[model samples]
Target chain A: MKEIWTITRRELQAYFDSLMAYILLILFLGFSGFFTWIYGSDIFFVKQANLQVFFSIAYWTLFFFIPALTMRLLSEENRSGTIELLLTKPISEWQVIVAKFLAALLLIVAALALTTPYYITVSSLGNIDNGAVFSGYLALILVSGMYIAIGLFTSSITNNQIVAYLLALSIGIFFQIIFQMLSSNLTGIAGGVTDYLSINSHFESMTRGVIDSRDLIYFLSVIVLGLVFSESMLMKKRSV
Target chain B: MDIVIENMTKTYGRQKAVDNISLQVKTGEILGFLGPNGAGKTTTMKAITSFLIPDSGKIFIGNISVNDNPQEAKKNIGYLPENNPLYEDMPVIDYLQFCARIEGIAKDKINDKVREVIQTCGISREKHKKISELSKGYKQRVGLAQALIHDPEVLILDEPTTGLDPNQIIEIRELIKKIGKEKTVILSSHILAEVEATCDRIVIIKKGKIVADGTVEELRSQAQGNETLKVTIEDGGLDEIFKALQLLNTVELVDFVDKSTQTFQVKSKPGQSSRRDVFNLCVEKGWTLTQLTFIETRLEDIFYELTLDN
Candidate 1:
């Protein structure tokens, strides 16, 4: 646990040092804040004190941002050959993968935290669904975690950061919208399976103040599977 | 701690990176690993550090089997891999601290450990600078510092001084020798002189297999099985000296080296010395023996002979 935290702290420091975290924060807050308050179907247009606009905007923003943040997590190490130095240390491959996941997740959480004033402003404006806002943030975090895991897996498979980013997006598209679109066009068991596989079904339910165990299971399983695959890819360096 | 490898083999596809190699490095020994490129020196070191798992066979670091408990075994090893890769964006101090933390040094002690390592590696003045900002010599120092942060019992450095100035190379070599006093150090280098200067034992590999293992003198004697001498006789004719030298019991063959200078090259019988015999023959014949130099086989010849293809 301490080893994971140490590595996570270094990775977080790297993000800030490289100015990636600050740029990501500004862009995320700018896009999400702009669309949620002043743009189409914004809060004033809806004439409601709810943050559904912010939550929806954040969902799409995070999907794009998380991969960018995670693209260099393992790829840079692989490119610079630092992975050899890192793996020779006392920590296991799983710990390194988990540490990278936590670092990106923490940065995402920081970005989400910066928008708390949105909640404050909405609550001050009128009656706000506090429970919905909390669940909405939870949904965004779960989605970010899932995408970060996929990004890490892609980074592990290649030493090129751009390749990692593109591969992650290609894989993430299915969970974000392709599966949902496929489900709508198909029928019967196939449609049902696609519907379950789509992230929107779970994310939308959570955004509406619902936290089912099944939804949590879906998000957690994807995160775990992605991390496991990344760890295996790292281990492949030894034998292959 | 002592390191023991038993018939370790690692293969990449059909090519065996390490082929049934076994070695033992005792505590307080500096074993120099010498080999041609792609001869499995790095692979063997990686296996010892628990970075590369062998296809078959076992490695034990003080009785801790690397395959069975790699994390435990890795704690006792400090490896400077080929090219000495590091986080170039991190400052020297921060990188060392990161290494110290990963090494599980206590929080309060981390700073002290980093400082000590920086001092030991002679990078104290540039500790605040980013690794990428440092020169190649300083960068190499940072690599050594991170490895020595935990003061592990075993140190595996692959080509530790590849791109350094001569002064820096000597400094690094001296530092390694100082550290090897209480630790098992395995350093790989293509520079024969550096290995001869620092290492206690040398292991030369070819085609993923160990071909030679011993001290400098041992390898020299092994290759220098027959004694050779270059003798210059002042008074006698070259042919007469050659024939007279050949008549000595210990002399195997004699050939004129330079007829104008009356110099002859003499080869002694296996495991025999002809210097004394040649001197007595010159004395009896009243011929002046101006120069009689023993020709020793060099390490380069031995390495070339062992590593070159048959």
Candidate 2:
């Protein structure tokens, strides 16, 4: 646990030192503000209190930004040969994986937090349900967590940062889009399973102003599966 | 504080990176691992440090089996890889402190320990600067400082002096010698002269196998012979020098190293010194010898002779 925290602290410090956190925050705020105030406002033609615009825009933004943030978590270490130094320390494989995941998760959470002004603007402009907004943010966190896990897993398989980024984006898009399409094409039990596998379905359910236990389980399972695969890859490399 | 490696092997796909190799390092002893490129030197070092596990073998670090409990076994090791990967954005002191934290050093002692290692590695002056801003020698020192921050019983360094100037290389060699007096050190290098100058014993690996293991004297004796003689004569023609030194029956081979200065390296029979014969030959030829010196067979000959067969 101590070792995990040490790694986490270093990783977080790296994000801040490189100005990555600041850039991510600015990008998140700029996009969310443009979508909500400029496009979704009454003056722009699309007037809706549904917040569907915010969710859709935020989700799409993360499809590219999350991979950019996490593509170097493990891949850069391997390319620069720091993985050997880290492995030589007195820490377990799981500790390293969890530490890196937690660090990336925290960065995404901070970026999400920057969207608070958007919520405030929506509230001041008209009547808004605080509970629904809170639930929406919660769903976004879960979705971001799932995306970060996929990015980490992709980063573990290769040392090239560009390859890691592209692979993560492809996998995230597959889970978010293809699974939903497959669910519509199939019927009965097969369709139900496909819908359950679709990340968008679970996230969409949570953003509808209700917290479902099933959606929480789906996101948590994705997180665990991604971390488990990452740990196994590291172990296999070490044992070679 | 002994490391015992028995029949260690590691394969990458169909290629065996580390073949069945075994060796031992006693307490407070420096063992230089000498090998050419792709000779499995780095692979074996990684196995000892538990960064890479062997396919089939047992590595015991102070009686602790690394395969069974790698984390526990690794606590006793401090490894410095060839290309030391440091966080370029962080200051040197901060990086060492981070290393101390991962090693589980107490918070109160971390500061003093980091400082101590920085001083030991001769990087105290550059500790305040970011690693990216430091020179290559300074960066190497930072790597060495981190390796020593935890004060592990075993230190494994792979090509510690790979890209450094002559002065920096000498400084690092002296530092390694000083540190080896108190800790078990295993350093790998292709530079045979550096290994000969710093290590107490050597293990030469070639083509993923141990070709020779012994002290410098033993390796030299096992090679052709331990005796060598160097004679530098005044400016003379090569044909005259060759004719002058070729008359001795005891001289096995007279090698002319340079023609301008007429320097010749004469190899005598095994266990025999050719200084007396060369002196007599010089006297008979009426050659005015400007300089005559005896040279011992160094590790380079042994390394080349052993690896040449492969």
Best by TM-score, which number? 1
lDDT of 1 by residue, B123-182 (tens): 988989999999999999999999999989999999999999999999999999999999
For candidate 2 chain A, which ten residues in a row score worst on lDDT?
A: A41-50
TM-score on alpha carbons, each prediction: 0.97, 0.89
Which residue segments of model 1 deviate by more than 4 Å? Answer: B256-262, B284-286
What DockQ does candidate 1 score? 0.89
Model 1 chain B lowest lDDT segment of ten: B235-244
True contacts kept of each: 0.95, 0.88
- The C-alpha local distance difference test score for the whole of candidate 1 amounts to 0.94
lDDT of 2: 0.86
Model 1 quality (TM-score) = 0.97
lDDT of 2 at A16: 90
